[model samples]
Target: MQRGGRVDGATLANLAGRDGGSGWGLKAVRDVHQGHRLITLPSGCHLTYGANDDPRLLALIDKVPSELWGAKLALQLIAQRLQGGESQFASYIAELPKGFPGIPMFFPRTALDMIDYPPCSQQVKKRCKWLYEFSTDVLAKLPGSPEDPFGGVAVDINALGWALAAVSSRAFRTRGPTHPAAMLPLIDMANHTFSPNAEVLPLEGGGGAVGLFARRAIAEGEPLLLSYGKLSNDFLFMDYGFIVEDNPYDTVQLRFDVNLLQAGALVSNVSDALGAPLDLAPRTWQLQLLAELGLVGPAANPELNIGGGGPGAEVLDGRLLAAARVMVARAESEVAGRGVERLCAVDRPLGRDNELAALRTVGGVLAFALSNFVTTLEQDKALLVGQAVAVPQPGGAGERQLQPPASEDEMLAVRFRLEKKKILSRALQRVGALSQAAAGNAELKQTAGSAAAKKGSKPSPATSKGFGSKKP
Candidate 1:
């Protein structure tokens, strides 16, 4: 606290036996009121790429890609770590975790494979590979000259990995987007929670001091928490080395492929008159409409999302919903002149039959995703509780005995996939309900038409309305 830093009613301590335990955390020493300032550190305590003033260090930093800001800061951290007692922040550097066992980059092959979700798994591998190459190919080859930043110290993959993990998990970009990210001393000790009790803010007058304030009243011994972001499990696990239970921000991603939609439509019983599989090949108008929505053409984004948190969150991305509806539409009259916004609204069903087809098609997509997982949601839950579950071997081989996760990494992987499965299952249930309701409504309309014919009255034809319709 001597370096122009202040701590009020809070103390750093080892947070054992708490949620995701065995980490250092800041805890309230006494009752603190809401909006109270709890901690403050002057600009000198902020560690950033610009903190190291050595000409050689700054020159070397310029070699790193601008987008790899984490790596650039990691280089600064490594230089300080090498300085040891000579460094101004030696005490803080020493307190930094020697190894990050929780990060997926450090997980064993078996534990990594347990993640199962390709999007996260592939990213983990890519980062790991880049670290290896950058360490050996770039840092290791630096010339031992006057410009040598590390003073000829051989930086290996292990050292670089440690530095990278430290920066990724703790650094914050408080000084706007244009400024490099900074690591705040003592301020970074706060653990993360979606519902944070405290928050980090800039001190008044903008003198470059960072302050932490209570967002709500804090009881004595309450752990001070800060929200990392509204991130999914993939980000939380990959970057922070932990996952929140029932995270509302979590989403399952799928590529927007017409073939997948075709399979979904077929499985949901959408077919042609000759009993052939439903054709999802977009016609000229449908393609134009999709292109207008940024789902087709060279610049189109194929990524689609589902299962977001909170009551107001959409279960399906609007673009994905619109595409599904447009693809299932067999006639131009069904969707002609309808604004893209109108087609995307969940409340605005095209027709009873059309709505059922669209809902069921999306359901088929989710079902296929769920089938890719080795264990069901129930099985995953059972495994988490220490129950042994049997899983099928590859290639239709006989089932093999699977035991409960033996390591924290493996357990996290299981938890991650489990949440994803829950999201898919929940989405499926919602669409299933919609499909059933639409079918029932269609049946009722058919019954009503039969009654009107028996009464010797011709039933009026239903007029399909598009956006901006006006009555005669």
Candidate 2:
């Protein structure tokens, strides 16, 4: 077996417990101080692209292109595992998890539909199909395939899928000869957490070596956890087969259609013109203007936090608000026969009228987005309230079941939608208040204008004071 760098004091050891199920995980043998070096894997220990040079393996590797480097490595692991006890990776393969939990990629379409996380499910389905094809069409067709010369057993698609999942979750991107991803024996064992207690850093001398250090003091026997970077539950489920509760980085994607914006502009600005259908050309022109301003497009998949944030902050992305404000002005100009330049200017101050218009426009935009998820939100809430079942399958009499009110993924989906609702609810409330306040301002201006016209002079100073003092 190939061993890497020497770990000081044997502070780290592999242990099996509920923490990692049947899979082995790294644990602290003794209370370790913050910044303590726990484990290190030298360059030679890493399993990287083109690491195995056997003629059969090379023939398979040559069939794979560099862009699919990770797939090649996964295939290599599968090939090695087929060799069983004779394989160089026998020890490593033995330590891997027996099965992955809640991995959508491995789940059938019916199972994926049960999870209801469409983005992750769709991506997994697409990738799984590719992996299956590569296994059946390419790798299985190579020389010595019929006899299974590498091992006594044939390498099949199911084996490839398992190896692929393992590699996807555990391998680290390394600066190897090909500078591709590799599996580091001890380093990959550290589990992930949002608040990680330890971190992996590249070795100073650069022998493909990496050191694990505690971010804070850890009690003896505590599991060594690492941050997989700040990732959302969607990414966590799709790539790692896990979810983090209350993940601060979690966000839902919201894409605005230009047609929706135009429709909303017409409703907000020209609703009273019962006889005339509004001209859509102005709204379309404004959308082009928004595009030129670098505000809206395919790439502008703005994220909406389930939690609350300011207008220009996280909740309603700033660029989205900017585009809405411009669209509202364009709507007004179409009705008032005026220019749309002032509203488009970046440096101009947002006067009271513009603020009111922008608020109404942005409120409509948020409402449209919130409407798309209403069914999902309701379904999630219903699931959270339902009772859990605990019966085994009819044929599997011996198996135990822990059916809950909802699965972990189901609970997470509910929580995420709840937060999004709260944010949109708050945004909508603000929009209503501002729109009302804008109406009051307009009324007050009209009343003052009448008084001034009757007296043939500007409004009295006392009236001006009352205008500024009126409550919104």
The 10-residue segment of model 2 with minimum total lDDT is: 463-472
- Tens digit per residue, CA lDDT, model 1, 321-388: 67777777766666667888887886566776567667877887777677777888999999999999
Give the worst 10-residue stretch by lDDT in candidate 1: 463-472
**TM match of model 1 to true structure:** 0.89
Q: TM-score per candidate, in order?
A: 0.89, 0.69
List RMSD in Å for every model shown.
Answer: 8.8, 12.3
Question: Would you list the clashing residue pairs of candidate 1?
Answer: none
lDDT of prediction 1: 0.77
In order, what lDDT does every prediction score? 0.77, 0.56
Clashing pairs counted in every model = 0, 0
